[model samples]
Target: MNGTLYVGVTSDLVRRVAEHREGVVEGFTKDHELKRLVYFEAHDEIGAAIQREKSLKRWSRAWKVELIQKFNPFWDDLFDQICG
Candidate 1:
């Protein structure tokens, strides 16, 4: 939790988060070491998910943090919650 923020769309949340946690993918998340999954949402359709991802990317940092805090008050890692 280095306070770095990255946003993207993923079809498989568990696999994608695992990749980030393991540093399996060489990119922004790995470079920033953004392992904690503080926030996420599921969309019924890929199109909608993509659109939402785009929207979230454009949001201000303050807005994004606020959203995350609302969803996760303590900013807890939700990886295990999803895995179990």
Candidate 2:
């Protein structure tokens, strides 16, 4: 579970995730297969999501993992569920 994690904000998570999975967009996520959508949040405003993303990016790995585990204790790949 020490895999790479890429944090960012996207209004259209579905399309954005598709790009990451296909490697259409090159970056840390693509290089490390960090395409698993293990955690996500819905905000009424993009600004809120952006702020939250920044906050998450600054969190320690343990803190981030705990946050994810709160909802997905097994760290399941939620890509299909969210993207579907």
Candidate 3:
């Protein structure tokens, strides 16, 4: 996928990513054609996940890229890994 980034929180990662991949919801992700799951993290609670999403949204583009590259050096789509 392209380098454009969109950050958000979802209770169901696989379902949410599928929706994005299928362009089910018309919003930032669909608008920008950002379907790759290059980076993700798990949280114990919805509140914590939301908090982390907010924090990531506020991060500078460079910082976000750095975080993603650290976790996934090749920026591979992780959708399949989660599905199984």
Candidate 4:
């Protein structure tokens, strides 16, 4: 909630999330300490998921927070939830 969060698309959710958490990929996620992954959506089509990621990325920070709170009211670090 106090740091940057990235919205991205990948075929393998677990691998992608691991990369972010481990700092394996560079750019906004690595630079801004955006590893919380407090929200995400799964799609069968990569294109659709990428599109959604783009739409979410374009949204203002406040909008993104509100979106996350729709599912995670406390903005918990969803990486832990995913791992479990």
Candidate 5:
């Protein structure tokens, strides 16, 4: 599945992504097939990550797309690289 997008923050990225991919925990991602792990960032502090997630959630779609392109121009599935 290409072109689907999702955004959020998780302390356990691998587990969260797996849940989405497998539909273990049903929600928007499962319903829409939003499993592509296009972009992510590491944060030493949960507060900072939460703040960043909030900030990102407020960003315009275009801004977010641009960001993903900057870090992942190919839109390749990054789960293995990240979670492996």
Candidate 6:
């Protein structure tokens, strides 16, 4: 099944992804069922994270899919891994 991509800044990856998975946030992600946590890159600064998110958003959907597939070919829910 195909899933939508979500890009946002968070100080806590574990907390953020858990919120997404648990449907705690009311937004496009929760609305469209886009909670698989397919891809993410951590950054030390909020500015850098925002920049990366914006840059990735500008990329084509196909490119985003490719990027995610590089690390997660099956588009698995990665919250557990990140928390572990």
Instruction: Compare the candidates by lDDT and give the number of the best one.
Output: 1
Worst 10 residues of 6 by lDDT: 1-10
TM-score winner between candidates 3 and 5: 3
Question: Where is model 5 more than 4 Å wrong at Cα?
Answer: none
Per-residue lDDT tens digits for candidate 1, residues 1-84, read 238888988999999999999999999999988888989999999999999999999999999999998899898999999999
Q: Over 4 Å off in model 3, which ranges? A: none
TM-score, every prediction = 0.95, 0.90, 0.94, 0.83, 0.91, 0.89
Per residue, candidate 6 scores C-alpha lDDT tens digits across 1-84 of 365667788899888888877889898878987667777798988999999989988998888888888989887878778988
Residue pairs in collision within model 2: none
Q: Kindly list the per-residue Cα lDDT of model 5 for residues 1-84, writing each as its tens digit.
A: 235667789999999988888888878898887766889999999999999999998998889999999999988889999865
Local distance difference test, each candidate: 0.92, 0.85, 0.91, 0.80, 0.85, 0.82
Task: Rank by TM-score, highest first.
Answer: 1, 3, 5, 2, 6, 4
Q: Which has the better lDDT: candidate 1, or candidate 2?
A: 1
Measure candidate 2: CA RMSD. 1.2
Better of 1 and 3 by TM-score: 1
Per-residue C-alpha lDDT of model 3 across residues 1-84, encoded as one tens digit per residue: 237988889889999999999999988899988788989999999999999999999999999989998999998999999999
lDDT of 3: 0.91
Error of 4 at 16 (Å): 1.2
Residue pairs in clash, model 6: none
| Candidate 2 wrong stretches, greater than 4 Å | none
Rank candidates by lDDT, best first.
1, 3, 5, 2, 6, 4
Kindly indicate the candidate among 1 and 4 with the higher lDDT.
Answer: 1
Candidate 4's TM-score: 0.83
Per-residue alpha-carbon lDDT of candidate 2 for residues 2-81, written as tens digits (9 for 90 to 100): 87767889989888888887888877777887667888889999889999999999999989888889989898878889
Candidate 1 segments whose C-alpha is farther than 4 A from its true place: none
Per-residue lDDT of 3-65 in model 4, one digit per residue for the tens? 666777888777888887789888778887666777888888888888888899899999988
**Candidate 6 lDDT (Cα, whole model)?**
0.82
